[model samples]
Target: MTNSRPVVNKPEIDFSDPDWKRHFQEDFDKQFSLPHLRDILAIKPRPTTFSLKSRIPLDDGDGAATGSWNGYVNDDDRALLKVIKFASPTSAGAECIDPDCSWVEQWVHRAGPRKQIYFEPREVKAGIVTCGGLCPGLNDVIRQIVLTLEKYGVKNIVGIPYGYRGFSDEGLSEVPLSRKVVQNINLAGGSFLGVSRGGPSTSDIVDNIQAKRIDMLFVLGGDGTHAGALAIHNECRTRKLKVSVVCVPKTIDNDILLMDKTFGFDTAVEEAQRVINSAYVEARSAYHGIGLVKLMGRSSGFIAMHASLSSGQIDICLIPEVPFNLEGPNGVLQHLEHLIKTKGNAVVCVAEGAGQDYLHKSNTTDASGNVVLSDIGVHIQQQVHVH
Candidate 1:
């Protein structure tokens, strides 16, 4: 029998206790384990001469080529993505209570080329699709995947048009892909394969995959799109299909937990900053003027916060994470009154999803099923005019 319970749930063990190592290992092995295709397909992995084992390292600043690089990430090569709750998040001084578990610290795998691969490159048919709203660096990501597959000697590469719809829609067809076809795609915005919202059923998509004999599927999308991808993968797995599904998370909001940032976040922040700066100029030019700029951040406030920080001219920043009032004594209106009286003008930056309570909540959703947010910017403007 094994103690499969999380280490945090059990009584705290003394630091001097010799059994700490054994106890920690039990939780890590069972609770934080990652899955592998080798076990799923029950197939032995083959040694990969990925890019012929001679790919150039990113650090080679002098444009020097590497000879037979040995940079294949392995199972032992893991990282700490999910940090256990050693202490309450607010206790700044509290971190890693059980520091003695040194061996358990070497967890999670780094992203890179693996020394062993499951699929045969020449015979592999790779399919790529982009779903959800457009974001920065999508084309770059697509181009990179295509080039990497080409380097691995995969000749039959195809792009799925207009997201999951491509598989079911008769008008949408698979676009043949190659190195030459994707060569300057990175210079452009949006995806070469195009993007769309909620499309055909996962079962139908899998049917197409089986029909087309797609060996590997690469999905690029936001959180909702990622869930759809996982559902598709699970369906394929249940059918015992020999297909590998890979996803590259791309959210302009950068809301994914335990992950650093998402693609296009920087671009979103930079564009928001520019808008805030413009608002600042307009506010300062008028007498008792108010400049209001709204940024994109439906749930998270990374875009609004970062843009406000980057643009020094913003006097107030409203984010979705923080609830604010407009009419009370301590509300935004009162604050604006003070700023107008003292400073004569002020620039306020807000997230699109901020202060939703002040507006109507409709059950309506978008093409991707995301709730269409009420216009907080317009609401704020109207409130200011009324006051």
Candidate 2:
């Protein structure tokens, strides 16, 4: 009778032996020293048609030829508005602290040129650094910055790799960014230079800026990143370094104070809508089944609200802005049970920061100094399963 067991092959040599290590090192050294190997690993720099000396005139009179709205602002009254000064209110919901305060509606206009020309075109050496979480249009924004700088005849542009940490890194390596390199980067998502949480000291960043001779620094991130940038700018000012720091707000939650919307918010909502649709289908297929979909939102409910509205199939929506009970008569669980009884199924959408009151808060924080949020989604899942 033939043997039915499978035959196994054994190695002739043991890789754990010191002889194997020596042999591997010898082979590696020999292969790496070859000229053909070095040539294969070398990266070629991208070519560009534009030169630093080439100037693209801002006022080329193309707006008049194209019948565009370029010089329309010149026709308006040019007066600068005075900054608004607010006094502290004694009570909440009061507009002013003084009871006898008089309201005045003064619309101050610009008295001089609205746009101030700061940096010269060709002399500008721009640096871009992206920090924090991934956003959809990061690459698009990077591409636009590079293209705009190139248009202004600014040839020296470098992208700092891996957030503020790049400033204090041992080698302090930065990628050379130009119109040619960033032309097709917008076709992809996320940042090409990469991103990370936490940052180096403000002095370190300022030192790197001074060392690199970067006149313009563009920081792309949310609130935490902006705060760091502000510190860096202050340090630069203290040192009398001539550097212009600009921030581009990037948050998928759309929680930035003055901004109406963020770049990735719409994309996030659109993607969440698809997940809600799938969850709704699953819920409808079973008797009295409940489908729960959780979205990204820390302190705000913008993503949850927009996703729920766009989905239209969500029976219950919960967010961090509002607190909801889980066990009361009017609680979420009770409401979901009632809905299941009436409609035979239920679908719920929740933000990640929702129902924080129900979970145990951990005394921990992330690298960005944000308090670690409990997983409300898993908590809700466990509660639902138990009920």
Best by lDDT: 1
Q: Candidate 2: RMSD over Cα atoms?
A: 22.5
Model 2, span 1-387: residue lDDT tens? 110111122254344564754554355346433122123334332222223233453432222223333322232353322123344334332243123222322222222211223456566789999999999999999998888777655789999999998888887599999988998998988889999999778887898899899988999999899899889877776776667787899998888753558888889999999999999999999888899999999988888888898889999999987888999899998898899888899999999988898899988988888889999989988988887
Task: Report the poorest 10 consecutive residues by lDDT, candidate 2.
Answer: 1-10
Clashing residue pairs in candidate 1 are 78-108, 79-107, 79-108
Model 2: CA > 4 A from native: 1-55, 58-115
Instruction: Give each prediction's root-mean-square deviation over alpha carbons.
Output: 6.3, 22.5
TM-score of each: 0.85, 0.74
Total clashes, candidate 2?
7
Q: Please, what's the RMSD in Å of model 1? A: 6.3
State in Å the error of residue 166, model 1: 0.9
Residue 41, candidate 1: how far off, in angstroms? 2.1
Model 1 worst lDDT window (10 residues): 56-65
Off by over 4 Å in 1: 1-32, 52-69, 82-107
